[model samples]
Target: MPTTSPFALLLDVDGPIASPVTRDVAPEIIGLLLDLAVSGIPVVFNTGRSDDFIKQQVMAPMIAAGMPSTLKIHAICEKGATWFTFDSTGAGEVQVDHDLAVPGHYSDEIRELVASSFASHMFFDETKRAMVSVEQNIDADNTEYRRVQADFDAAALEAMIRLGLGVERLEVSLPDANSGIEYRVDPTIISTDIESVALGKDLGARRALNLLSADGIVPGAWFTVGDSRTDYAMADWLAAHGHEVSHVDVRPGDGIPAGKPYPVLTAGDLGLGDEVIHDHAGLAFLRHWRAQLDPGMVINSTELSEASV
Candidate 1:
């Protein structure tokens, strides 16, 4: 069945598109994606990767592997914390719309908590809002992940109470067992002052989406893809808002649900999973969904791009 709405193909990087280090992208899958592009289907890659990293590592190689130069491919990087558009006119340069920089005007108490806790573990990186994260190696088998996690949790709560800041949202994430902890802080409850440090690491992706939506990029026409639990905010937001397509879980055990609130596609294993997405089963699934939607639905990719500009 032919797709009607010119669907947005949201791809996750590590699982569905490319492998790490080798940076090998599947040729047949690229061909299929390019075919989708030629048919005017916009393919936007959404992942936890940063903007500079995606261009140097993922997009460049993909274009080298036959993806079109003018392929209207957009990227939501940093787990959807930042948004970028590849300028086909400028040697494929990526333009950033949102960044994970901490907002200015953070309460002094929040800063003190971060400074006090920063030395206990090498795991802490930066503080945003009431949350602080570090880069300590976590033993998935040690049962101590919870203990260390509790420490962070306690710190977050104390910081909020001491500073008279209210919690909006908080999360402690382990992006990699070897990479350390990733934390998020949402302090809209404290004030709309928008402190630079209040944005936190994990909130980047969700913040980017909110920024895009505010610019009139309706959720129904948008799609998001990611490899890990860190990407959950963007995925959850899109699903709750009824996005047209939200392809997630491009990595093995990315912890994506088997049946999602939205249509889900899993790549099975990293890099090699691209082959599965291009197979007959994958195509059939897309086709079946496409046949049900109305044609000529206007999607506002420019809204996201314009906001970034």
Candidate 2:
């Protein structure tokens, strides 16, 4: 153990393991993730991303790179509306809370809304089984997409009102949110998520922890890594459940949140400048833990830094 007790990792997918620019996982990340799992770390992926997206972008790569069947991994996807487990055999049967899904007609309306109005800037996410999400097109200019995103978000609110759906709109810029509301419009850097009030990072955290505990994989310490403010909920849930945990914000440029019961870390704390945010910060921390678990194990920081960039 690195400390008095072993620690498990709770991770958010995007902006951590995957490149925001390329929307893909890197080979180095795959290797490091497996190294940790193989070394007895319990790793869970908690994200608002859909199971299908995770299956393709994160899971497939890990399996191909040789994730062992003995190592079980849980993915809490679509916030908390759906989930599945995986190992070397590939993703297991997916479980979903269909009751939490927005009405299909509403999803259909939003799907058409994006197609008819925002096709240039975004595209409807077909893989989503619960939430209604539209991500910024990879080829779209960030400047232009951010500019138009508000308009689309506003339009979504109107669509919900027209459909008689109770709604609240949450922004990453605003940290506090009522996660139990009937519905919400959450806008992030590359996408806007419309989900039930029951779906949240907190809910995802609870699910992952329970899943791990059920299998007797509980750890004395947990490290939750993410790039968004909402990601704080993971650590919040763990602490509330009487677990010792810390949260690492890979992109702290938005500002470190104030008054958390647990310690909050940022990549900048390790001296990675503002320029090296997001996945680069995530890489640094993963390497940090890898070294911690195997004290003094030499990782070529300079080489890994160049490769991650």
Whole-model Cα lDDT of every candidate shown, in order: 0.44, 0.86
Q: Point out the worst 10-residue segment of candidate 2 by lDDT.
A: 171-180
lDDT of residue 173 for candidate 2: 22
- Which segments of candidate 1 are over 4 A away from where they belong? 1-4, 20-23, 66-69, 87-99, 102-224, 246-260, 263-309
Residue-wise lDDT of candidate 1 within 269-302, one digit each (tens)? 2222233432222333333334334355432323
Show how many residue pairs clash in every candidate, following the order shown.
20, 0
Residue ranges of candidate 2 with Cα displaced over 4 Å: 1-5, 171-181, 299-308
Candidate 2, 1-309: lDDT as tens digits: 122228888899999888888889888788889999888888899999999989899889999998887877899999889999998988899999999998999999999999999999999999999999999999999889999999999898888777666788864222223332478899999999999878889999899878887776768799999999989999999899899999999888788889999999986666556677777888888887888888678666565466446
TM-score per candidate, chains pooled? 0.48, 0.93
Evaluate model 2: give its lDDT: 0.86
lDDT score, candidate 1, position 108 = 49
TM-score, predicted candidate 2 vs. hidden true structure: 0.93
